[model samples]
Target: MKLLRISDLRAADIEAIWSLVGGGDASLRGTIAWSFEGNGIRTRTTFIQAFRDLGLAFTELPNLLKTDERACDLAGYLDPFYDAYVVREANHARLAEFAAASRRPVVNAMSSQGHPCEVLTDAFYLHTRVAPLERARVCLWGPTTNVLRSWHELAGVLGFPLRHACDRRFHETLDKVTFTEAAILPADVVITDGWPQGADDPRWSLTEEHLARMGSPMLLPTPPFSIGRELAFDPLRYRGFAGYAQKQLLLPVHKAILRHVLSR
Candidate 1:
């Protein structure tokens, strides 16, 4: 199966997957052609037979419906476009429509709306670490930009309750969900992710003080800074586990979704 990921992944990062596949089944192509005023196309490599990026070379579509149909046709005509069309964290409504129209499995790798697949990874990882979803109380503290989609998807799929805490800027976005900044954290689980580059606030970070109150077996998407294996006795903190692992592990699931969409 072929894969198209526009999430700025480096060629070397997927080396392990390439090695196992006996090498050179995939190729990488970069492009910003879908969006105007975007960066130009770049090149990379992968395990697939080939990969290509259109870059910001054209803007012929004036209507979303028409653009989507064109994209769908492109996928249909292109030999490597069938397996998956991963719209990586894009906010393009037309692209989503095109993906749906292309009859290709669409992967919501990351989106301004939601990160459902990441939520799947989190659920699987938590289930493997903990006993049950009900047994865990997750505290999600960060900007809604990244977690918004994932949160909803997680709740829908696992029924696991999540308590949210966001800054004043995003309070309106949290209107649908019950939340409080003063809510006691370090519950069964705590997540502090998706930092804004220029933002000054750091209230959402999992500080050392926060770790003190954490229960046994903490899970942090990013690891803490420590020189050596001092083994800080702050429960079994699952650190350094990135969201990309989910993308790799869930390839089969994505493939099925792609096949079903394309079969139409």
Candidate 2:
């Protein structure tokens, strides 16, 4: 059996996975569930819908803070029942440790280090809504947080042009990557996850003035966006904005990946 981490998947494999999911082959079914300990309505809703659509059994473990020993024990317990595990937690190190201990394939929902699944959905959105990914200019605004880290990882694999307009403090020390102040104006897609939890940085906010300058580019703010913090106006008013539809794109790819893992 092989571990199916997004970092290990090739570009072709990603395309194939999405294609498999979009085809909606009802024959594919399995026991899929998530073990998370935070508020992730969008991710949770999307996974449940994906599992239901694919005719797979879905369950969510109770939100419990497990000790390392208990976490490992639970993984062994779930090994006999589940085909895949989606984990969302604040600690990346612990999540990585859990994935290593788990017998089944582990899908990272989100962690302190990265959010691969969300980035995968972003890729799918660009593939369908915007230009070809190889030629697309993606501008990431805000901190070098988990989402940006995942994008950085993805850029290495996919060879896409990813530029960032971030605070000097949040800038990543990646080689050959461009960090620009003018990225918002020329970007094909402008993405932001907003500021860190309690920090208020007005300069990073996606104000109406900034949007006006972003000529016809797609706007994707990672879900549960704060109106005043991330965007000045309601994103629902923008023609290029992606809300639930962006989330919907994740379903097929997620289902496809799970199905592929099960077959292997």
Candidate 3:
């Protein structure tokens, strides 16, 4: 019952999660233990609410688990006291290893490799509000990062058309991501992750003019999105900007995920 990545679940699994969205199974009383080192304000706060909604007791792991050995050992160390582990840390290898060592279920909230929950939430939004994911044309605009990787993994699993609009310098090694900004034109939905740190290129930025060019595709900028960087202008001015509206479903989505994980 470990959710390490998006490919771990399929379309049916997503549907199952959707079916269980609004109402949760509270009979399964499970306590959760969580630790965070990644930069995800939206992810952290939303899950805390999810914990409370499910009536699940949760505790924050202290910052003492620094070393890889101690971090992996934490699963067995806290196994008796905690029912489940939620970790949102930076190291992909360490996260995988810690999940391996844990006897209880491990939920990867975010990592250097992917953000499964966020991807799943976004996919759920598309399926429920926009279109079936199999037919949706997706375009992600930004540098290659964890969220993008998760989307890529999801695309491979769901058989959807995913076009990445990024600068050639950023994705020189990535074959699937296109070099030109024209990749956003034919998309049904356009999404974005954070711009590469210390790098600012307006060419890759999303502006009203860009959305207008795309003919008003659903625009979802993954959070911690910058104003002048990933977004060239204020996003609230654009009608297609559905970032906030889309993320509002995170509560139910996270509740479903927690229910599924803890029940198993």
Would you give me the overall lDDT of model 2?
0.73
Candidate 3, 1-264: lDDT as tens digits = 788887787766666778887785464587898888855788888899988877889999854245755655667677899888888877777878777878888888888899999988998888878898877777888777889889887877766667787777656443333445455466788888886566677777878777777777878888877898898987787777785767878888888988887767
Per-residue lDDT of model 2, residues 193-224, tens digit only: 85777657777878657766867677888877
Model 2 alpha-carbon miss at residue 108, Å: 1.2
Model 1 regions lying over 4 Å from their true place = 1-83, 172-177, 197-199, 214-217, 222-264
TM-score winner between 2 and 3, please give it. 3
- Count of backbone collisions within predicted model 3: 0
lDDT of each: 0.42, 0.73, 0.79
Candidate 3 RMSD to the real structure = 2.4
- Residue 107 of model 3 has an lDDT of 82
Q: What lDDT is reached at residue 84 by model 3?
A: 88
Best by lDDT: 3
Cα distance off (Å), candidate 1, residue 109: 2.3
